[model samples]
Target: MSFEVGQKVAGKVTGITHFGAFVSLPDNKTGLIHISEISDSYIKDINTVLTVGQEVEVKVLTIAADGKISLSLRQANEQAKPETTGRPKPAFNKENDRNYNKQPQSDQAPRFNKSSAAPSRSSYTPNQNNSPKKEGDFDSLMSGFLKDSEDRLSSLRRNTEGKRGGRGGRRS
Candidate 1:
């Protein structure tokens, strides 16, 4: 009934809660399998994956000073699987391969120039050369942000005024 960290043990899932599942261990002690420790992928609901009285192999993650046990189903499953060597093959893309070997256009320079002074905030103009400006460019970005803010404020004001029936206080 002695349990050490990283030891794989089988247990019966006795109960399940929103946060975790309670597993009855060999020593009559129960350990908790946290929602995060249940799987490598996202789990919206634990009941979808586990049910009462179901047998599961869990790795002993930790034993707190107070004797609380933390277990991981994911780690136990991983330990049971054999390890593979070498990196996974990169996905092939014809366009990416062509672009990777191509040289940059001679007319185009690096995006930033160390010699040139930074443009002043006031002097900045967007879409000057008819080329599409990046969304992060200052002028267009500020204008879009201001417009969105104004729209939200106006919506809030209209909703409040409608609720109040255009009056400031209750009529006597």
Candidate 2:
């Protein structure tokens, strides 16, 4: 018998593999229940969840052109869950509101407040040099670096210049 998508059917577990479990359906057709669809929670081992000859109810997910069926055990259980109420929830009253419409104190800057478990920026000072940096200091810092670099390069060139000609002093 042909099964429609979303159809829940009763079957028996015929085989189990690392990837999935095969269920023998009504028409002697076997469908594969992927490892991910086995349970809501993670299942490290399919053997722990299912065994050979175990009865199971599965929801039909898709039917391939080559007569392959994709089934879901989780979706089958989901179908049996009772729906939530259609009635609307009551509106919240200002008095009953948790915050009570009170504005946060200016002192308590929640945006800057991080979890106590983590190190706060205010507590963790990145200034390892113990120097106070200002916005106008970038140009001065860059110029100082350039001067230092030029001095090093000039000294390197002077030291290497005498060694360039030969391994030993040339014969006259």
Candidate 3:
């Protein structure tokens, strides 16, 4: 039998594979219904949807020069459904008046209050003693850091000076 693209033909499922199912067509011809073409929904397994020797209606999608045929069960099923008029007419709101000529009340750009737009610093107050309390708090933190730095420098200088004096002679 001569097979053409878009022709719906009934065939028996001969083999099921991970990728697709092979359907044996009339005249000893065979076609593959890819896992995707098997159904409109996601198919995790082809065995769940098709079985060997099961009959299925498939639409011929393509015929390769090598005599390979590609078929789609979904396309055949889609052809069975009646076509709709596209979309239903949208329902209109009767109460709302369509104002085509009314200009916006104010043409000037809308004014926004600056204070409410962003968070204020006064809203947050840290409770911990280590946390800075006010603007001058940073100065106290800097003074403490400076004192600690000076103490560390003095201790390092004393240690290095003693080590240098004890080991005055160069290694022989």
Largest lDDT belongs to which candidate? 1
Candidate 1 regions with alpha-carbon error over 4 angstroms: 84-87, 90-97, 104-172
Give candidate 2 misplaced runs (Cα > 4 Å): 84-93, 105-172
User: RMSDs, each prediction?
Assistant: 11.9, 12.3, 17.7
Q: For model 3, name the residue pairs that clash.
A: none
Q: Rate the local accuracy (lDDT) of all candidates.
A: 0.88, 0.87, 0.86
TM for every model, in the order presented, reads 0.56, 0.53, 0.51
Off by over 4 Å in 3: 84-172
lDDT of 2: 0.87
| Residues 1-172, model 2: lDDT tens digits | 8899999999999999999999999988999999999999999999999999999999999999999999999999877888977899979898888798789998886875445558756765334344565456888778766866787788887777667744453445
Task: Name the 10 consecutive residues with the lowest summed lDDT in model 2.
Answer: 125-134
Residue 66 of model 2 has an lDDT of 97
Reference-based TM-score, model 3: 0.51
Locate the minimum summed-lDDT window of 10 residues in model 3.
125-134
Against the true structure, whose TM-score is highest? 1
Model 2 misses residue 59 by how many Å?
1.5
